[model samples]
Target: MGINLQKGQKISLDKEAGGGLSHIVMGVGWDAATGKTGMLGGLFGGGGGNIDLDASCLMFDEQGNQTDAVWFRQLRSRDGSIQHTGDNLTGEGEGDDEQIKVDLSAVPANVKSLVFTVNNYTGQDFSKVANAFCRIVNGANDSEIARYDLSCQGSHNAMVMAKLYRHNNEWKMHAIGETGKGRTFEELLPQIKPHL
Candidate 1:
């Protein structure tokens, strides 16, 4: 269901040319009716509401299944690779802001590329989502790469599937779709996948 990124390992946008490292900006957005859509206030969230009670909930137990809300994914040119990850949940502000750090040195041998993703965790109420968009760039030098846009807007929070890019290119910013419901990872998954 997700990819886990540790300390080391990665791939380049261009293997022969050497995939320059950058910041991939994955952003997700949606109109929400959640009150106290920030930290602390969500502590009161329970069954009556769907907001998470914790502000630092990168992962949570959804319907008895333990899933990580935050993660990092990589694609290897040799063995199978993970192109996306889970950003968990953060009911802090307007968007469900989550980030995964990237280092050129972190690219593992044979790795080709990567995709940063956010997990959705909305209950059985969101079914009106439309799209998920992603932007790539070298966060340090601020170089941008190709972008992937989809019509995936939904009724609840969503898991930013991922902003994919080649490793040999100048990598950078990533934008994951955030349509509300950041209190928990499970409640935010719907914003990314409309059919999920």
Candidate 2:
């Protein structure tokens, strides 16, 4: 069980069992939205189609400068602190479509923040996506800590979903469901800057 988070919500990464959370996993999932059928559907291959959503994490130093990125193009960070499970071409799974595991204790000291993002790799806008969600979990116990869902339909193809950052010597997760356009992380960088 986890706290169902809304856009702009923030939670401290303190463990309930009493110590700092050493490992955390960020999970993102989504499915294609059901669209019009009949003539309109026929025009677009009958409405049902796979949505390829790519989950990515960008690490930033104290100055909000990106220091490392973990995505399909690069599976792991330079310091091996963050690792993307793999790419999910279709949002057909029951749980997280893509997972990015992070060893909080292993993260470099200079790295002050980590932003998690998702982009439509197939160039489809989020109006074609449904049930899209982003979550954080305590890896050691496999317990969900917080989750955010992009429940509304939109025309954008990417989003700066959420961020995990160090504050007051503790980690915190912020729900930043900001919509943008990009097929990859590089293209989304500019949009992400304002959110930093």
Candidate 3:
């Protein structure tokens, strides 16, 4: 089993993967909350609808400038080191609704950090979502390294899920459960700057 990461927790990817960590998979999953009873329930018409959540990766330089991005629109990074598997419109899956693959060795040295984010493309707030989680897996053996459950429920439509950054020449994972209002990665850029 992998570590169940809490908000603000950090783990070394190199140490976790036992040193041969060339590639990793970041998976995000969620399901629509059901049977919500309140004003929100009425607004969502009893609360059982497809939630279109988009998973995205924003690459930043050592100076915190955005160098590249990979999301539903652009499935691959400019340098081809990162690739978003695809978009999941309904949020109706047993496993990961979306997955982003990162080639640690292939990532340009200039790229210092990769921020993973998820937004409700359907414009529904997180109160309408449930069981949301982001996990890191070893692409070599398919073993989970760590997972962060997105348990914050609120009016926000987006979340800066987690970050993979370079520290001491090694990559590390940080669980950042910050919430905000945004329908896409661009809208969340400002909120993400402070964390980087």
Tens digits of per-residue lDDT for model 2 on 1-196?
7888888888887853246799989998888776534677757675456789999999998888999999999999999999999999999968899999999999999999999989998887877888889888889998888878876687889998998889888888888888889899888888778767
- Kindly indicate the candidate among 1 and 3 with the higher lDDT: 3
What's the true lDDT of residue 39 in model 3?
75
Residue-pair clashes per prediction, in order, are 75, 0, 0
Measured on C-alpha atoms, candidate 2 has an lDDT of 0.86
By TM-score, the candidates rank as: 3, 2, 1
Using alpha carbons, what is the TM-score of model 1?
0.38
Clashing pairs for model 2 are: none
Q: Tens digit of lDDT per residue, candidate 1, span 34-68?
A: 44234554565422243221211122122322233
TM-scores for candidates 1 onward, in order: 0.38, 0.92, 0.94
Tens digits of per-residue lDDT, candidate 3, 25-111, equal 999999988777677767867655689999999999999999999999999999999999999999886989999999999999999
Candidate 3, residue 19: lDDT: 83
Better of 1 and 2 by TM-score: 2
Say which prediction, candidate 1 or candidate 3, comes out ahead on TM-score: 3
